[model samples]
Target: MIDSSANSPIVRLVGVEKKLGRQKVLKGVNLEVRAGENMVIIGRSGGGKSVLLKHILGLMQPDAGEVWFRDQNLVKLSEEQLVPLRKETGMLFQNGALFDSLTVGENVAFPLRERGNVNDAEIRSEVTRALKIVDLPNQEHKWPSELSGGMRKRVALARAAIARPALMLYDEPTSGLDPVVSDSINKLMVRLGEELNMTSVIVTHDMVSAREVGDRIAMLYEGKIYIVGEPRDVIESQDPIVHRFVNGISDASDAIF
Candidate 1:
């Protein structure tokens, strides 16, 4: 396990800017995720959380500024050059994003197969190990259609971790689930990070999950990060926008024309 206490950032975004179509989504955003820490990003519905996530993944280059994964600057890397770096990262999409046609085991082994050269036995072994971590062992043969929402999510998580990447990115891992199930997912995320010793950047709107899983919380408002601090600090912030968001209050009428 890497020493998470190290001050150096595993991921850093420096003055990142992006404009999607005509909308300026990210405006000079800057943030960092230290090694092996779980950094949860919370924001309003259109606060550029996903856009920022894309920059980290090297999926979308910032129109200005830099995205750095350790010493390498992602902004300078071409798609081919970025492939090796991307191999060290795993992403769990909002909806699980599993292939409906594939069985659970196949889904988990997808990354391995794409990388090629591994024998079928090794792939199956890795899949079983990952499934056990997610607490869904012996579920290899089931189709995604046969599993409940929670089970499907576990499968997605297993798939994400099968490669044993150094970093994990989760987009709304608790979305579309019951409160109890959402809490369970939150716990699983924490367990995975601890057991695998992987750094995580979770983009979520679920305050409960954010508080429970995050080592630090970053709140994005408008087009910039309004605040970044410990979950308790972020929750107890006296700032009006932060207060309104944390308490789920809206003063939209105040902005009425």
Candidate 2:
């Protein structure tokens, strides 16, 4: 699924727009993430950050414009046709979607077994590797209910990465974890890009996470990417809104005092 030698943007969103009922969730989003790049997006709550992630995952389609994977336009593909493309992109949801009925190994094995035709021995081997990658190799036989919040997140990460996707989309990957655990996840993200050469798109509220893992940072405000560049550049910008948003300046730029 991943060929590092192939160059070009692995994922691109061109003039994309989406609406939910009477509300507009995204307005003409245009962005591109190149191969093996780590792009982090930051935005206030309810600012359509989550909605935009869903669009790329094809969990929801845009009402207007295109979501592309290099040359393949995802918007035009049927459910069956999109399967292979999806397999190349792994999504770590905000809430780890673990099957409570299954053990940690089974949960990690879920995607592989459902979407792949691997043999039983290979499946077990892959499951062990995934757990080891997350530093949870000992939790293989434990149920979801037995794990802590951080452990659950690690399990989700393991599952998303088990297939060794070309692209990894993380939705609040470090949300519920402590500073130490969050820092570990951040370092792992950096390693994924540097060592494994995997492209990553991360949506996060944690500014620290943004700075740690991002090769570049983009901020979404009013349903558009208001700023895009190096982490410190975007965070320390004189673009009043950028400064205000990052530093929590509450004055309304859309309104005149």
Candidate 3:
């Protein structure tokens, strides 16, 4: 029972390639993320997970290959042309990436403010609603330094979703939290995806978080997607590389190594 829009993927990377300095970070990587689905990308450090996300965000263009959003080939579009597309997408960085000087409410309203059409009161109302969705009701006056790690992350997530973006990209959403906090973040992601009706792409190495939030998991290795499957399928995979990853084994002979 896949989404009817599944036939039209929201994001598709066709043989994407990128090189940074002396290393080829993405070597003909290919993937398709369907609309209204939570697609998680998992890999070791330096395996090009973030790089791939950057490509989708139009922060980077592949040296060769096409990156498509809906029907548009993003690589062919100029930066000016990509602005509307970027606005329709939201990104949660590894860090909260909030402006230290901005209050939580202001942080959530940043995007709306940038658009310059919404009045102050409307921005305030949207900010309050987004904050409430993240379960941080009436905490708009708090500063980033005053909030806990989990709260800061939730604020960041609220900011990302404030625009009601059609696509949401999360980078290592649970990177620096305790187990209980991590689970909370995981549940929040699932809930947001359901309630907002937005397609989500998460980049992380945390298997538990991936299992909890992902509808389909893609494993990046050697700058390419080595495998893509459901969480249970990934866990039970016979592929040595997947097995090694699931079991947290390090070996020279691993395919992903």
RMSD values, in order shown = 2.2, 3.1, 2.5
Runs with alpha carbons beyond 4 Å of true place in candidate 2: 1-7, 252-257
RMSD of 3: 2.5
TM-score per prediction, in order, is 0.96, 0.93, 0.96
- Cα lDDT tens digits for candidate 1, 1-257: 88556667999999999999999999999899999899999998877998888899999999999999989999999999999999999999877889999999999999999989999999989999999998899999999999999899999999998888899999999899999999989999999999988999999989999999999999988788889999999999999999999888879654648
lDDT of each: 0.92, 0.87, 0.93
- Where does candidate 1 stray beyond 4 Å? 1-5, 253-257
- Candidate 3 at 208: error in angstroms? 0.8
lDDT per residue (tens digit) for residues 55-97 in model 2: 8888889999899986898899999988888988899988878
**Preferred candidate (TM-score higher): 2 or 3:** 3
